[model samples]
Each structure stands twice: as structure tokens, then as C-alpha cells.
Target: MINNKTIEKFREIETPFYYYDLDVLRSTLDVVKKESENSGYKVHYAVKANSNPRILKIISSYGFGADCVSWNEIAAAIKAGFSPSEIVFAGVGKTDKDIGAALKEDIFCFNCESLQEIEVIDQLASKQKKTARIALRINPYIEAHTHKYITTGIEESKFGINTWELEEVIKRLPSLKNIRLIGMHFHIGSQITRMSVFKSLCARINELQIWFSSRSIDLKIINVGGGFGIDYENPDKSPLFEDYFSLLNEFIDLLPGQTLHMEPGRSIIGQCGSLISRVLFIKNGSNTLFAIIDAGMTDLIRPALYQAHHKIENLTSAGNIYRYDVVGPVCESSDTFAKHIELPETRRGDIIAIRSAGAYGEAMASRYNLRDLPPSVFSDDL
Candidate 1:
């Protein structure tokens, strides 16, 4: 929630900036740390969610590991105080240069998504005279019931190794002496609200565990990639970390000496940040009132990209409520944020807050349309 004082602070700063409440982030991290620690589960903060240096530094301070998709993200995580040994690298299209860099860093493990990727990593490792630790990212073919663009783990998705290829991959592994298989990884999708989805993943993991055990494979890690959702409507409400951890403990059957790991991104950082903008003008559209905002898809692209919703609030007004189509200055018609949303009587220069933007908002920003990226503002600084 943007308090009266914070709104006043917003008036002093430039519009179209990201505002992060450090207290909210710390509180959310506290819950995650407590719940995961109680279950003896290792958590790797998904760096792609919000790789702001300050955000990364705060997360690393919690002693959690990092899950990175690129060598650049790994470098940022390391600069933010995350230990290289605690970082796990994952991506479907990892370039040769990135793989070589990760091999040199000797990071924790690579979540290998394809058979060819495994071979490449082995070759890279052989060239570097090092043994690369890897975990097979298996496609469980589970329905995440999320947006199609974000859903993975299906047979049609190019994100993970298909089940039919597992036999061949296993047969060829021994020949690649430079790599060692240590575990398995699965990420169904992002913004998954249903617990049933996770339960299904656990069941599949258990079945795969049995299959591996029969083959005398002693797996050491079970990494269920994170996709826990947050309440976008209610920005103050934190994610249900306790319930999520409890469900995993009840369902996933782990062998002795094995460890459970997760890579949470959105749930940890979504609620603590918001996009602060100002009403550029209040113009009449053909059928509705348009509250055009200074912030656009260039600053936060989730709405334009995924049709995602973020609660819009007029921070400076408390007059009679009216409906408006909140839009951005981007040239694209898809730059709309919310349509026919209720806000207090608004006008030009009124402060607006787009709630639940902390996770992918700033991280996915672009300089499209030749606009500058929005700067970040922390609560402590204000």
C-alpha cells in the first residue's frame, strides 16, 4: 500500500519510476527462509525475476542460493554477494560462450534441458579439464493451467527434455566422461495458483524416482522449479509460503541423503514493488475516458505481453470514483495497462500506482520507442 507520506514523497520525485518497499521485501524473505528452512529445503532465488542490484543483494543476504539463466545474470548475482558455488545455471538456448564461462566459474550445477545441451556441456567441460555437475530438466507433461506462452513441461514445449529421449540420454551419458549427473529439475509454469499442479508434479517426480532407483541411480537433488503465484489484486497480501512448503513435504517422497531444492522468483519479489507514474492527460476516448500515463510498456511489459492485470490506484485523489482506461504513452495500442478500471476522480498530473509489479516489471523493461528506462526508488531512500 502506498501511504499518504509515500504519496507525498512521490510528488517530489520524477514520475515513471519503480518504488520498492524494503520492509515488504524483507518480510517476504523472512517467511520464505523460515518455511524452507523448517522443511530442510534449499531455496535458490530466481535471478531473472528482478535482477536489480539492490534486490539481488538483499536476497543474497538471506543466505539463499541463486538460479540464473545466463552468464551475465550469474555475474550480477556474484557481484551482489551470491557465492558461485551456490548458483545453479538454467536455460534452453545457452550459448557456447556462456557455457564455457559457467564451466570456468565452477558453479553449482547446470539444469540441462536437452540431450544436445548435455553433450555440449560435456564437451565444454572436457575442454576446460573440469567435471560439470548437471541435473536433467525432464518434461513431466503436466498441465499448469496458466497462459500458454508461459506454460512449459508439456511434450510440445521446447523447454525441457522429452520423456521418450530419456533412455537414449542415459545410455549416452557414460560416454561423456566430463559431466556428472547429480539430480533432476522441473518447472511447469509461472503464476501457477493451483496447488493441484504442484501435487501432480510431486507424483510424477515420485514415479521418476522409482524408475531411477530401479536402474541403480542414486539421485542427490530434486529441484522443483518455482512458479508460486501472488495476489495481484491485494498487493499487501504475501504469498502462501507456509502452505506451499507444507504441501511439498507431504507429497514428495525423498530418499535418504537426498535434498529438495526450489527456485522461487515471482512470489518472493512481486508484492514489494510498484510502478509509480503520473497522469499525463485525461482525454475522452470514443466511448470511455482515457487516463494516459507517462509510464508505458517500455517500463513494464507484463500487461502488454501477457494480458496481465495490475491494480491501478490514483494516489493523489480521493474524490468520487469513476471508471477509466489507464493507458501508456507507448505507440503500440497494446500498451494499455487496465481498461475501464475504477479510480477516484483523476486529472492531469495525478499520481498513479500500478500495484504488484515488483517481480518482472523492471527486469523485463526495454528501451523500445527510444524511451529511457525507468529508474528505481527504494523506500529507505525516500
Candidate 2:
């Protein structure tokens, strides 16, 4: 919570910056560690979510593995102290350069989305005189009940291998000498709020694993890709980590010596950061008041892109409640944050804290429209 005293100090610093609460972050990581340890789960922090150097270093200190999508993410993870063997690469598209780089690094496993990708990795690994460990990312066709844009496991999604292709994959696997199948991976979608969605996923995985069992294909890992959602309405509240892990343990029937792996990103860091922006103008419209903020879509695109909600608060104001159309200074009309949201009677120079932005906020910032990217200020620094 940004109190009045904190807001007073914020005046001395620049507005339109990301302010991270290290205390909250540490507490969140503590809970994640406790829960994952209780279940003996191998948790990896998804580097794509929030790769801020400070955040990554702190997470790495906790000894969490990294889940990466791109070559740069793998590089960043390595630079931040993540062991190459503890990293898992996953993406729909992988160029030869990227594959070769991962092979050179000897990353733990590549979550291969296609049989072609398996062949490519096998070819590259053979060239490098190294054996590549890979996990087949299967399309479970489970509806995550999240936003359509984020849904990946459905049949129409281009993220993973379809169910029909499993037979062909198994038949071709014997020919790929340099590539070893170590696990199977599944990711339904992002921002998954329903536990039932995950339960459905467990059932699908159970059904699919039988085919492998019949073939005596031993898997060392079951990498369930993460999409755990955080409470956007209540940023102070933690996600259901205990319930989440327990649910997996109770439902996911694991084979002997198979380890559980999850790639959590948003749930671990979303509540710990806020995008602090100053109110640039208080314009009165015909039937609404507009609180135009200095920060734009370039700084935080989730609101514009996914119509995602982040709790907005005027950290300085102490006045009568009033409704405001909180918006940003971006040229596009989609730069709006919230519509007709109630807040204190806002004025220019009022600092607004956009809550629960720690995950996708700073990591996704861009210099589009020549807007300068906002710097992050951790709570300890403040």
C-alpha cells in the first residue's frame, strides 16, 4: 500500500516509473518456495514475464530454474545466475541460430512444440556432437476459460503438437538419435483462474500418458506450463499457492521417478509492483471526468491489449469520491486504463499507482512513439 507519507516522498522522485515492493516480493517467493518444496515440485520462473535485472537476480537467489522462450531470454537468465542445465526452452518457433545456442549452452531440455522442431534439434545437436534432451509440448485441447488471445491448448491454437500426431511422433523418435525424450509438456493458456481448468488438464494428461505407458516410454519429468492467475482486484492478496500445488498432487497421477515442473511467472511477481504515474490533466467531459496520466500504452500495454484490469489509485488525494475515466497520454485512443472508475477528486500532479503490474508491465515496455521507457524503483531504494 502506498500511504500518504510514501506519496510525499514520491514527489521528490520521478513519476511514471515502476515501483516494486521488495518486501512483498520476498514474501511471495517465500510462499512459492514453501509450497513447491512441500510437493517436491521443480518450479521455474518464466523469464518472459518480468526479466528486470533486480527481479531476476532475487528470483535466481532462491535457486529457481528459468523457463525461456527466446535466445535473449536464455542469455538474460544465464547472466542473472541461472544455470544453463536448470533452464527449459519453450516456443513455437525456433531458428537454427537459437537451437544451436541452446545446444552450446547445454540447457536442461527444449520443450519441442512440433516433430519438425525435434528433428531440427536432433540435427543441430548431432552437428554439435551433443545429445539434446527435449520434452514434447502436447496440445491437450483444454479450455482454460481465460482470454481467447491467451488460450493455447485448444485445437486451433498453434502452440503445441496435436493429439493426432502422437503416433507419428513416437514412430519418428527412434530415428532421432541425438535427441532424447525426457518429458512431456502442456500449457493451456495464460491468466488461468479456475482450478477446474487445471483439473481437466490433469485428466487429459492421465489419458495421454497411458499410450506412453503401453509403449514402456519412461519420462523423467512432467512439465505443466504455468498460467496461475493473481488477484488483480486485491493486489495485496496472494494467489492460492497451497491449494494449487495440493490440487496437482492430488490429481496428477505421476509415474515413478517422474518429477513435477511448473513455470510460474505472473503469480510470483504481479502483486509486488505498481506503475506509478502522475496525473497530467483533469479534463471534464460531458458526463465524465478524465484523469489523463503521463504513462502511456508503451509503458503498460496489458490494459489496451487484453482489456486487462489493474486497480488504479490516487496515492496522494484525500477528497470526496468522484468517477474518472483514467487514461494515458498515448496517441492511440486505446490507451485508456479504466472507464468510469471511482476515485478521489483528482487533479494535475496527483500520483496514480497502477496496481499488480509487476509481471507484464516493465518487461513489455516499448519505445514506440518515441516515448522513453520508465525506470524501475524498488521499495528498498525508495
Give the alpha carbon lDDT tens digit for every residue of 1-382 in model 2. 8766677878988878999999999999999999888899999999989999889999999999999999999999999999998999999999899999999999999999999999999999999999999999999999999989989999899999998998999899999999999999998888999999999999998987897999989999999999999989998898989889988999999988999999999999999999999999999999999999999899999999999999999888889999999999888999999999999989999889999999989999999999999999988876
CA lDDT of each candidate?
Answer: 0.95, 0.93
Q: Per-residue lDDT tens digits of candidate 1, residues 197-242? A: 9999999999999988998888899999989999898999999998
TM-score: which candidate is best?
1
Q: For every candidate structure, what is the RMSD over all alpha carbons to the true structure, in angstroms? A: 0.6, 0.8
Q: What is the lDDT of residue 87 in candidate 2?
A: 98
* Residue 179 in model 1: lDDT: 90
Runs in model 2 lying further than 4 Å from the true structure: none
Collision pairs in model 1: none
Model 2: what TM-score?
0.99
